[model samples]
Target: MIKCNNVQEQAQDLCGEIFERWRELLQSGEFILGDQVLAFESWMSDRCGGAHAVALNSGTDALFLALRALDIGPGDEVITCANTFVATVGAIVAVGARPILADVGDDELLSVETIAPLVTDRTKAVIPVYLRGRPLDIDPIIDLCRSRGVAVIEDCAQAIGTMIDGRQVGTRADASAFSMHPLKTLGGLGDGGMLVTRDPGIAEYARIARNHGLENRNESIRFGINSRLDSLQAAALNIKAQYLDQWLKRRVEIAAFYDDVLSTTRTGTDLGRGKPGNAYYHYVVQSTHRDELQAYLAENDVQAAIHYPVPIHWQKAWLSSQPRIALPTTERLSRQMITLPCHHHLSDGDVEKVVTLIKQFERAVRW
Candidate 1:
């Protein structure tokens, strides 16, 4: 079967380099919060337009830390998109803040217009999730938040290389949290994340906070968590980081091919016509027969999946309060979005084969 992502295949190319880094790490023997971690942090900061990047154990922790660093806690409302991964809202809840929901635009980004209505005196921050590797049009949201004295934390888990007007998405917010999960475009060996911020205060606080809020080895400056990005993961990530641009290029090429084909067939809708430099992490398409299309693709050995099938407020966790908010677009799109294979490992032939199978399905429907 043609799988959605072949991380193993991609990792094969970097095996030697990673091993070398690992060996060097072992020789240096700085395992916990070592030089490698600092190196990776520096690399990411430089790459993401000079933002101060603090490496952490997971993107979830990064989000929690970013919120915590900002002193956003109970009674504070953090606004985010209704159609985002649970982590976006979960992060808000993680920091003991109320999560206010907002609808999305046709591009599936948190509608800047929809968010303004959700803003109130309680709104402390706006966490705009950069879904499917497309940076949200964040300037308007930034303007709105600044006027209201609200912070912005960009959920950039799927948006490492994504650019908006030549600047990376992570650098566009007050703070941005990125997950380097095994499935993300910039996948690490295991769970890893980074928080980027232009604010030096936020950056310093995150750096101190991620290490259990310790100023020195024994001095506990504040309450924090142990969320360090390990030396080994840093080494592996540095190896992968070298080839990220090329990988993103291949992913873009594959997405364009699928977009061109799907446009003609009209079997699916690409709602992620995001900002110009989107990284196309999971080439998503919306369709009425999303479930059917997914099943048909699986049957044909073309692995297709959905980014998310359930809206946040509709999840079982929220069934108690049952948020009585109008999110018609988010509710409708949740059941209609399907993600296709847009990994770097797939070749031109693989892309063509997948498109051929999709077109075949559309043709079959006509008959």
Candidate 2:
């Protein structure tokens, strides 16, 4: 079966070089906060066009640290889209803050307009997620937050290389948290994440916060956690980072192929076009018969999945005594979205086969 992502295959291609560097790191015995970590941080900062980048253990920790660095905690509420990975909301709750769920736009990604209604006196931050490699229209959100003194922490887990009007996602937000998980556009061998910020002070504080909030070797400045990206993971990530642009190009090509092929099929009249700034992380499409389409793809040897089927507000863990606020757009997307295969490993032939299979499935179910 064709997997949604092939991180192991990509890593295997670079494992030799990565292993050699890993050996050097192991021999040096400077494991945590070493030269490799520093180099990766600098590389990521330059790539994201941020003043500073702090490497962390996971994307969840990156979000948590970003929140902590900004002093957003407890009685504060963070405005974020309901239709996102639980990690986005989990980070907010983990940091002792309330997650204010907002609806997504027509493109099925977070937007400033949908977020405006969620903002209030208790709202301290906004995390506009770049879901499925599609860069959310964040400029307006950033501007709105700036005018209201609310911090913006972009959830750029799937949009590592995604650009908005030539500027990267992390460059626009007050801080952005990126996941280098195996499924992301820039996947690492293991769990890894980075926080990017234009403010040196925030970056410095996050750096400290990632390592148990210690100002120095033995001095504890504040409460923090052990969230350092392992040296081995960094080495693997650096190796993969070298070929990220090429991989991203391949994904774009595959997504284009899907668009061309799926457009002609009698699947659904409305396939829902991606926004101009999207990078097609998962190449999602909207179909009224989403469940049926997914089942049909499975029968035809095509693996398809849903980015998120349940909105955050509906989750049992996040439920509160507060009255349920209706989010029509998010609720609608939760039922209509299906993600198709769009990974770097897919060849032109693979794209054609997947698209053809989807078309075949659509034809079988056109009732």
Candidate 3:
């Protein structure tokens, strides 16, 4: 099957390096959080343009802790894209803040224009996501938030290698959250995440907050949670981080191939093309017949999935409390986006086969 992701195959290919790291970690006997975790954090910091890094248990925690570090809580409003993973809004609600959903532009990304009008006195922060690893010009967003005194926490969960004007995306915001979930370009064997910030105070707060808010072994500084990155996961992540650049390069090549071939299809709309900075976490296409197309691909052994079928605001958990807000573009696109296979594991032939299958589906729909 042409799966949306090939984590097992990718891990199998790196079994030697993974086993070696695992062996060293097991022998060290310092497994919880140690040199390995610290090393990974340092590496991430450097990758994010020298930002102070605090490794966490999951991407969700990274987002939650970023809010904690910023003192954003109850009664405060946090603005984020409506069409995002639940974790984005979950982080805000987790921190006792109200989540304000903003509509995305045609590129399916948040912009200063969509966000500026949402800012108010209660606005504590704005979380702009690099959805599908497509980087937007964030300088304007940063400038807008700065002038308004609202913190900007970039949700870089799907965008580790994503760049803008030669600098990585995580470094541009006040604090950014990243996930090392196995499907990510720089994923570890298991779940892990990192929070990057340019501020030392926020860095110190996150460091303590992740470890039960203890400044020392005996003294507690604040009420915090246990969200430390595991040494085993860190060890594997350290090994995987080495080949990230090449993996990203391969993903872009596959996305470019998809763009070139799929662009001609009349029923489907190809997005994120011709952008050098896009990490192509998921090569997405919008079609009026998205469900039918996905089913057709599945029949042909070509796996395609939806990144998110329901916008966060429309979720049952939030539907009761969230006022009926109009996010036309977000609501409209939720039913149309389909995530195709675009990973480093696929070869040229694999990509061509998938493209051929999609073309076949498109042609059949035309009739």
> What TM-score fits each model?
0.96, 0.95, 0.97
RMSD of each: 1.5, 1.9, 1.3
lDDT per residue for candidate 2 within 1-367, as digits (tens), equals: 6767776787787889988998998899977878888888989988876468999988988898899889999999998888888999999988899888877777777777788877898899999888877776778888999888999998888888788887667777788899988778777788999988898888998888888889889998888889999888888788888888888788777777776767776543223374555667778877778899888778777788887888888887767634477789888878987888778777777777777777676667756
What is the per-residue lDDT of model 1 for residues 310-349, given as tens digits with 9 covering 90 to 100?
Answer: 8888888766644667788887778888888888888798
* lDDT assessment of candidate 3: 0.89
- C-alpha lDDT of all candidate models, in order: 0.86, 0.81, 0.89
**Highest TM-score, which number?**
3
How many pairs of residues collide in each model? 0, 0, 0
Q: Model 1: runs farther than 4 Å from truth?
A: 321-326
Regions more than 4 Å wrong, model 3: 267-269
- Higher-lDDT candidate among 1 and 2? 1
> Residue 320 CA error for candidate 1 (Å)?
3.4
Tell me how far the alpha carbon of residue 28 in candidate 1 is from the true structure, in angstroms, after superposition.
2.5
